[model samples]
Target: MSTRSHSAVMLRRNFKHVARNPTSVFNAVLMPIVMMVMFVYMLGDAFSVGVDYVDYATPGLMLMAVCYGLGAVATAVNSDLTKGIINRFKVMDVSRGAVLTGHVVASVLTNLIAIAALVAVAFLLGFSPSAGLFDWLGVVGLVVLLGLAAGWFTVALGLAAKSPETAGLASVPLVMLPFFSSAIVPAEKMGPGLREFAEYQPFTPVIETLRGLLAGAPSAGDAIAAVAWCVGIALVGYLWARAKFSKRA
Candidate 1:
């Protein structure tokens, strides 16, 4: 079958799967909302860094949305593996890209809803984007790319996991990287050595880049760092996931 035809079929099948499981939808939207509310209210005072903490936090909340979106890839992959659905796909004449396109596209769309909800919540709490429409589009584009790269890594994790619990536990590190970087606080607040490390951490640059875009500031260094991290993660994740998928197949 043609790749497009295959992708359409797979997309339909996956959408059906999601539709049948309404609880997954609830969790996808609920989990991110909970995190956004929890951190913006509880941790805002503890990590005051000279800005409206919510404004500073909007990017971080967006990142969390991306992270949660990526988890859908992991969860779907895990569900397929647990039920031998992947092996069934292997027996079909489906194009390889079909599986990926369906899962990733559905995931991105679902997450966009959560993103809109989160943005609305942020606005309700006094967070406003200083960025113009084009710049805001750029932010969304960058976020989708970042989420795509991260999604592959999570796919690999789900493929390699021994159980659903292991897959769930594995997401912790993925979500924590942003918190440890300059996402919440200014990196300067850390010890000198830690500050330096935070400056160099992958998420720090991405967060900084997004911050500049959202704040209506143009920052070349931040843009370069964000692109670098996205590309690097995509390369590593593709390599790892390809290797694991080959072995599993």
Candidate 2:
């Protein structure tokens, strides 16, 4: 069979594994919802961004949801590796790229589901967005790019880990970075040192770009920076994962 055909098989296998795990589903879907509720109700009125706090916070919440949803990619890849399934696949002549492709695609699909659910709940909670058709398309495109970048990066981490437990923690930093970004608070509001970090971090451009898109005023500079960062991350992740897979598996 062709590599694409093999990838499809692997994809189905990975998808089934994730679907059978309730924890994975909760992390991808419900975690975001819970965070959204907590942030909106607990601190919504405390902030005074130019827009409503709910609207101000949605972009950040979506980003956290994406980060949380993708943690399983590393776990799944590590599970196959630690269980010797990768060696079995090798003996069976499975394409290496196909195996990795399966994990990456499955991860992205999980995040897509999580994003959809988050957006729906956001609407119910009065999260108003001003994006037009093109803006919405841009948002989806940017998010998918991020997922691809994160998916491949996590796959590399998974391949490098000695166990699935370590791999499962690979995405924790990503999940936490939004808090230090402009997602929940403006960079200007932060202390001098932290404000600098907040302004320069990758997630800042991402959240800024997304927020601008949703607000109907996408900044050319932030959008360019966000896309550049995503492309760079994806490229780096692809090379690293391929090298690690070749070396180890």
Candidate 3:
């Protein structure tokens, strides 16, 4: 079979697993909803500073959801690795790259769905964006790119981990990164040291770009930086994961 066919088959397997066991999807959807509510109601007034906190926070929450969802990808890949599914595939006639590609594609799809659900909830909670058609397209593209970068990185982490538990734990940092970024608050509001770190981190530029696009004030510089970060991460992660998988096989 062609590599594309092998990937499609593996993709269906991953989707079936998601259908059968949906705890990961539930967590991905729930985390953002809970965070959005807490941020908007508990700290909205203080953080609003004239603009609606929901509006200010929705982009961050969306990005956070995508990042958090990477845990599921890590866990799934780790499970397959530790359980010898990858080894079994190696013995069969299949494209080696398709195994990782399948997981990455499924993960991107899952994150997109999670993002859609989060956006729906945000709209219900009075999070309105002034963006037009082109801007919305840009938002979609940004989300997919971010998902690909994060998902691929998690795949590398999963393969590198000695156990599934370690893989899940390894992804904790990805989930926590938004807290230190402009996701929850403006970097300028942070102190000197933290502000510098937050401003330069990968998540910040992505969040800032998303905020700009959704708010109808696109930041060309931030958007470019965010794309560059995603591309760099995806390339590194793919190469790392491919090397690790080959070594294991």
Candidate 4:
């Protein structure tokens, strides 16, 4: 079979698998909503910086939605690995890039849905953006890119994990970083030591960049730093995942 044909076949198969699984779709949207409510209500008042707590939080929550979608990708990949699907595909005329891309696309699509729902909730909770349509699109684009970058790492984690449960359990740090970073609270409010650390963390740049974009303000150098971090993580993760996939196959 041609390489394009093989890729198309793999993507179709994966999409069908996801579509048939109601639980997967439900959790993708549900988890982000729960987290947003918990943070906005419980921590909103206590977590003030200069910005509106929820507005500052919306970007972080959006990132967290991406993070969770990637974690689900980890679960799906590990499940496939455990079920011998990877080996089955390896023996066939399969394109590894297609296989990876298919999963990544599914992950990005899922994150987009979750983000939309989260944004709706944010809007109902008095969250408003000064951003224009283009700016809104840019924020969406950034979230999608964030999902893709994080998906690479989760894919690697999936390949490395002993089981699906283990893969899910291993993603705690990715979920936790935004809370400590400038996502929920201002860097200045954190301890001087932690504040310094959060200032330079990967997610901080991402959050800051998106925050500025959504606020209709100019972004600082952090935007470049965010792109660098995402691209760097994606490259490293893809290399590691490919190596691991080769070994497992």
Between 1 and 2, whose TM-score is larger? 2
What is the per-residue lDDT of model 2 for residues 1-249, given as tens digits with 9 covering 90 to 100? Answer: 899999999999998898899999898889998998888877788898888888999998888887886678888888888899999999999999999999999888888888888889889889889999999999999898888888888898888888889888876787788899998889999999999999998888988899999998999999999999888988988999999888887
Candidate 1's C-alpha runs over 4 A off are 15-23
- Relative to the true structure, candidate 3 reaches a TM of 0.96
Tell me how candidate 2 scores on lDDT.
0.88
The alpha-carbon lDDT assigned to residue 99 of candidate 3 equals 95
**What is the model-wide C-alpha lDDT for candidate 4?**
0.80
Model 1's TM-score against the true structure: 0.88
Clashing pairs in 2: none
Ranking by lDDT: 3, 2, 4, 1
Off by over 4 Å in 2: none
Residue 174 local lDDT, model 3: 92
Clashes of each: 0, 0, 0, 0
TM-score of every candidate relative to the true structure: 0.88, 0.97, 0.96, 0.90
Judge candidate 3 against the unseen true structure and give its global Cα lDDT, from 0 to 1.
0.89
Query: In model 3, how many backbone clashes occur?
Result: 0
Local distance difference test scores for all models: 0.76, 0.88, 0.89, 0.80
Q: Pairs clashing in candidate 4?
A: none
Q: Tell me the tens digit of each residue's lDDT in model 4 across 32-134.
A: 8888888886768976477677787898888878776556678888888889887788787577777777777777777888899999999987798899888
